[model samples]
Target chain A: MKKVSIKDVAKEAGVSLTTVSQVLNDKRDRFTTDTIEKVLAAKQKLGYLPNKNAQQLRGSKTKLIGVLLPNLANPFFSTMMQSMDANKESDVDLFFLTAPEEDIEAGIMHLVERGMDGLIIAQMIKNPERLNNYLTTHRIPYVVLDQSDDHGFTDIVRTHETGGGELAARHLIELGHKQLTIVQPAHLTSNMNLRMEGFKHYCQSHNVATPKVIESTLSKAGGYAAVDDIIASHSTAVFATNDEMAIGIIRGLADKGWQVPQDVSIVGFDDIDIAQYMTPALTTVAQPIETIGEVALQLIMDKLDSTLTHRDQQSIVLPSELIVRATTARANLDNS
Target chain B: MKKVSIKDVAKEAGVSLTTVSQVLNDKRDRFTTDTIEKVLAAKQKLGYLPNKNAQQLRGSKTKLIGVLLPNLANPFFSTMMQSMDANKESDVDLFFLTAPEEDIEAGIMHLVERGMDGLIIAQMIKNPERLNNYLTTHRIPYVVLDQSDDHGFTDIVRTHETGGGELAARHLIELGHKQLTIVQPAHLTSNMNLRMEGFKHYCQSHNVATPKVIESTLSKAGGYAAVDDIIASHSTAVFATNDEMAIGIIRGLADKGWQVPQDVSIVGFDDIDIAQYMTPALTTVAQPIETIGEVALQLIMDKLDSTLTHRDQQSIVLPSELIVRATTARANLDNS
Candidate 1:
């Protein structure tokens, strides 16, 4: 079997090789309809397989993008991917990179080796400066999908993580809650740390005691394991960073003969779809996932189109809001 | 910058091109350690980017596999992916292929075009013959991950979806539930249909009134929307195919002034990570996702290693069990 080249298609269609290449590559506006049809028919008949590597070497785009995610199992990331998938304009393929690595430098190198045109980095943990410098040196087009505006110098599509933290605290404090606790999964993330800072600062300024923070896994098991310690503190209110942990806290409290809101109020972050359907309907902070997805896609597309240059840096921040529901209420005066 | 060929590395290292190629690949045992180091050093110093297209044409494995899933946002799929990641050998990269299409023909084509070594199709729909024929024609090694063994002829790794469905029905019937309902997501998946078939068959044999079936999206919103219709039907027990719907049922029922296990006993399928964390601590059927992942990996690995042939078709069926928790209880005689 021989590889079908543009010359073969041109000879088969009785047209120039340039015409065949242009027609196959969406540059058919200059050609007549009959000529375009002839080129396409000949190419199809000859069983032409496009040499993507050769095309990239010839200044033709690969139409391939890399998506780096910390955890694919996390629904938040999936939502972002789905949003991008919906906004796709062509046959662009998205390669997901999740290798359980602490950082994505090696992953980025692999993507570059594979000839990716751009990348989207979500839920990052590495320093912004280091990554920005590396991407800049490599001439890779990328946007950081984060939940906070802590990225000092880089292209970032983020939600107001600090405002979200302050909103949760403000809502609880206004409910007359004196004893409060913050439950976060794993260590404090870049956004989680900012949230913690904002939460503490607001409490201190208002003359309220700062809430004790607990670090655990982002899963329900982690939240379940910390139930005893949380109960021992006798906090009237709890703010879990993500919805998964907050749901676990509710069950653990239930097992210990405690009722939510009536005994202990609970608030969660990332108002995922399931949050609204939980028993008592969790009160949470909503991250604009769809907006982040759309903005991230647009930024990467602009870079790919050469409209956004390397020197052009952007750090667009979206708003994160608190959604009050059945889980939170005025702290029982006696419990406080 | 010029392309560095294997010959260049050989010339620099003062070794044969064949020796350099062999050392760069798996056949390194025959070469001396000194020679191998020299070849590697020369290859690195020249900044050689190995032409993967040429390597693939020469029968070198891509070390890339595609995992085709119906929904990546569903944590069940993520759990399977994580399990596969844990069982990963060497540096094989897993690319997630998810399109909004119901059939995976287009997705399969895209993966093949991108040069995937193999594929693992999880939560598959009906009709194995079409996919089996296509895969066989293309010589692409693949295994269908059905939750039920209703496939006509193909390689499949599945759980006892029939037994799972029957187990839920048996538990509800034993609890004195007469008017029951099976709430499944969508129009009965290949696995869900079998579960429904088994559940209905057992009830028919026992002279018990067969439960009614409802089709909707596999989300909380779907379960919430169907609450009124289910209550109007006077269903004392409800069996949701997944935990998402079951959780929604509990919340929807509470909104309608009914309590789980008191007015209605609800059982869910796929005891996901958040199941135990639900306020009522959901009782559900657990799919052996880890076992499925391991088995699926083994099947694909066997194919890649040439130990498993296309003629060697296997249909492995694993058992599933019911986990009774706080969500299910003895039916109230008054309600019946």
Candidate 2:
């Protein structure tokens, strides 16, 4: 298992070291097709891994973008990452980090220290002004997604979370659900708070009883654990801030011998992949997840390639829609 | 948004540049607590992001580890990654890449070129020999996980795939299911192939009819699309290779007016977080996901610290267990 160098590739290809190096680095227009093929074959046979550090040291673009998300275990985030990966420029490479609230600043700094050309931060930053100051000062191009407010620091790309929440509330209200409950995370980000605001606003405007609120962790377990409280509230319908929690609420209801949309109607936000696969088929607000990912990446690429000026900050907000499924039905008066 | 230099930090802290540098780099024992706090406060106020590349140039350890998994969209992999992130050493940083079949080599080379001290590859390498040669020749400490065969080149950590399959088959059989079906991915990895082999072997040895096989992608949509074929097979029980596909199958069944464990029992592999939250509560083969993640990181750390010898290639195979939830029951003779 000897380390194969450019010299080994050149020797195997019967070419000069320069030819091997040039061909491997995509500087192949000057070389004959036959020579380039031979060099590639030799490199493959030798399992040569070109030292990118050397190229990087010589002032070559790494074309590496760093992406920071809240968590990957959530299908919503994972699917968004997949979309970004699929749509990114073929030559560009992406590295990912899970930057929960506590680690957002550290994650960005880590990526910056590693010399990422640009970054896409998809987590809530507790101190946006400070982070914005750091990125701007260092001249690191970045895009912020899903943050409560951009604070006018960087380009932002996100779905209309408030509108999404309004849609969820409207759909449930149309189904004759007057007494409702909204399950949300205990610690609300600006985005989550906006969603709550929209739902409450819609309910208040409709002359329905203001929906009760139950705070949880924004996970399936969080939703499952809130079932006892939900039962105690005697609400005819519930709105989970996200699909994962909706799935949990469904299971918890079944465990309590209650049928979804029969004894209790439910609405969820974030039409993640599993939402459709839920037995009762989750009725949820559908965020344009793929578009959000694509737009975020495109913004970063634009910044990196100088197609978009850093000073001309842009905020792109995509619309969300309500997708009615079996999870919602007309209120059963007997249950009320 | 002025770029803050070490000189500024020094002036802000009312200390020399050398003192600020030493305090920031953990050389604080020579200074009093008051001076250390001053340096830290100054650094925080200025939002300084230390350039680790300078330290790397001076031959300081980056302590960066690269993790390559097939896809993060799958909860099994995502959860494993979370566990790794939670259990990694305080100073160690993990950067992740999603390497599907075509990108494995490129991803490895990218990480290597980025100067990762050690790597944990959790994907199925199509050509392990060549990659092994490349890694070993470079003296890069690495660990392989979930590969069908190790090829005796590197340390491997995996669950007993064959035994996991056997457990699934035995559970269904014990519940009096005879007409069984196994839904799996069309492109079978060695681990998956082993799971299929074990299930078929158990059925044959028990003198039961060989279970029917349905090939699809290893996703929820794959299982959802196979429902028609499953119904055609007249199987009273089904084993989906993973929980995602199992979820799809359950939904597909429900859509076609069938009931799980009543009309056809269902069992799934990989007891991911959402498995228990499924309406019927999926019966699944549970792998030691957290333990595997922790062990893999520990192995990489051991290699990085020189506590584990390069020549001592360890292959650790953890056991898998079956958790019987409400997804399975005594097979209905009427369905068969």
Candidate 3:
């Protein structure tokens, strides 16, 4: 098959060259919704992979994107990687950080030295100033994915974490759950904090009292170990930040002969593959993991291609929603 | 912490330089059992991280190892990656192939151009000869991980796949399962084939009828979708090749009003993190995933360091075992 070009897309969409360019760069708000839809449809029809070859600032493009992520093995990250791979502009490979807990500065420096055009990073660090300085000083084209950074970096694409938290809380509250336990991760990120804030906002606005927070790891083992505390709290419903913990909670509850949604309803975030297949089928807040990844890669590609008109640092927050599954039910006041 | 060298380990083990080298390269057969134990204990004590610095083969030593795998998000692979990360040489980093299914040849070529010292591959391909030729012709130091390759590659570190198959089958058969169904993946690799062979061999030797094979993806959804056929075939026991399928089987069975072990016993391979925490707690054949990864990385490091006296090829097959959990029980003949 021949490579589809931008000219072909423009002609097919019946739009001006600049309009097509703007639409491609996610300037959808500039155009009417119908025009944006038309351009996208045309691009889809023409099978146009963006021609990023026009503007290659870095000498001889390496066709490699470096991805630095925290908790590399989660389903969410895996799905994100898959999406990024599928939506790549051309034949490009990703250089991944082996351990996010370690010094990521070295990894960033290594990727930069390797002549990669751009990078996607989402890892934790105590000295953010040092990392920011390195990237800015080196002028490496990069974006942070699924991370909330106040740093004046190039760009970051994050899920609507606060919305997700609020969605979960509202779902539980509407189900008549008053006494709730929020299973928080031991190592919290800004996104998690935002999620908690959203949940708190919803609870407070709805006249619900402050829900107890149990600091836990996002792993299944962590959730399993927190069962005693959850039961002891006498809460009717539990909102674990991620699905791994919720699954563990369910299993842990089952081991103790308690039924989900019957004895203790549970809600989780990141509707991972296993969540839907669990015994009670987890009720979760869906994180658009793949979209975030795809969009982040696109932004990086646009930046590398010099298609980004505005050089100012920008953050894109996508929407999140609640997925009601079998694990949650109306609260049982008598049981509590 | 100070860097521990091989010399330090040798001194601690009360062994010569050559003895330490042999032990590090897994030449355990060449030494007495007591000698091997002492060397291992010493190495453990001294904390030797395989100082491949002694013998460097690459022009400048890029210190980047490329890892290619089939599924990106599996717990088994995640655990393996974690182990490899933990054990990697201080300066070495891993460059990962996100989607090995699409044009791995291009990815490998790019990694080679970028001067990756060596590669670790585990992906499905139609023609193994072509891939092997590319590696050999280019003189790229490479090793196949998890997947079994018969194409005389430099090195392959894999689980005892056939043994795993036999273990799962035997566990089910010993439980008095007269009717069994093996949920095989639609796309079978050499490892999966070996697993089936071992399971079949066990059944034949005992004069038991050949268990039917149900072709499915080695994912939860695939296992769940294969349920109707499983029930239709009236199999009392299921031996899914991996835990994902087994979990799906359990969920699918539950959705159809059947209970595991009591109605349909299920056994899976790879004893992933979630297996032990499942509702019934899955019975699975455990693949030493982390060990396989560590050993594979060691082999690659050894090759790069020119520690291998014979430049021919090496294949290391590690042991696999069955962990009987709550998912299996005595066959319900009455239910049948």
TM per prediction: 0.83, 0.86, 0.80
- CA shift of B299, model 3, Å: 0.5
Tens-place lDDT per residue, model 3, B213-240, is: 9988778888998999899888889889
Q: Which ranking of candidates, highest DockQ first?
A: 2, 1, 3
Interface RMSD, all models, one decimal each? Answer: 5.3, 4.5, 14.0
Cα misplacement distance, residue A125 of candidate 3 (Å):
4.0
Per-residue lDDT, model 3, residue B119, is 88
Q: Clashes per prediction?
A: 1, 0, 0
**How far is A220's C-alpha from truth in model 2 (Å)?**
0.6
**Model 1 C-alpha lDDT per residue in residues B227-250, reported as the tens digit of each score:** 987888788899887888888788
Best candidate, DockQ-wise? 2
- For each prediction in turn, the share of the native Cα contacts (below 8 Å between chains A and B) that it retains comes to 0.28, 0.46, 0.26
Off by over 4 Å in 1: A1-62, A101-103, A125-130, A147-153, A307-311, B1-59, B123-130, B147-153, B307-311
Instruction: Write the residue-wise lDDT of candidate 2 on A1-336 in tens digits.
Output: 223567888999999999998898899999999999999999888767765655654556667788888888898888888889888775677877886688778888878877677889888888889887778767688898875367877789878888988888888888899999999888887787888889999999999999999988889988988899898988999999889888888998899999998999999988988888888889999988888889999988888875344457889989999999999999886776
Quick one: best lDDT, which candidate?
2
lDDT of 2 by residue, B1-336 (tens): 223567888998999989998999898999999999999999888766565655664456667788888887888988888899888765787877786688789888878877677899988888889887778766577888874356777778989999999999999999999999999998888888888899999999998899999998899999999999999999999999899999999999999999997999999998998889888889999999889899999888887774444546678999999999999999899977
Query: How many steric clashes does model 3 contain?
Result: 0
CA deviation > 4 Å runs, candidate 2:
A1-51, A307-311, B1-50, B307-311
Pairs of residues at least 3 apart in sequence or in different chains that clash in candidate 2: none
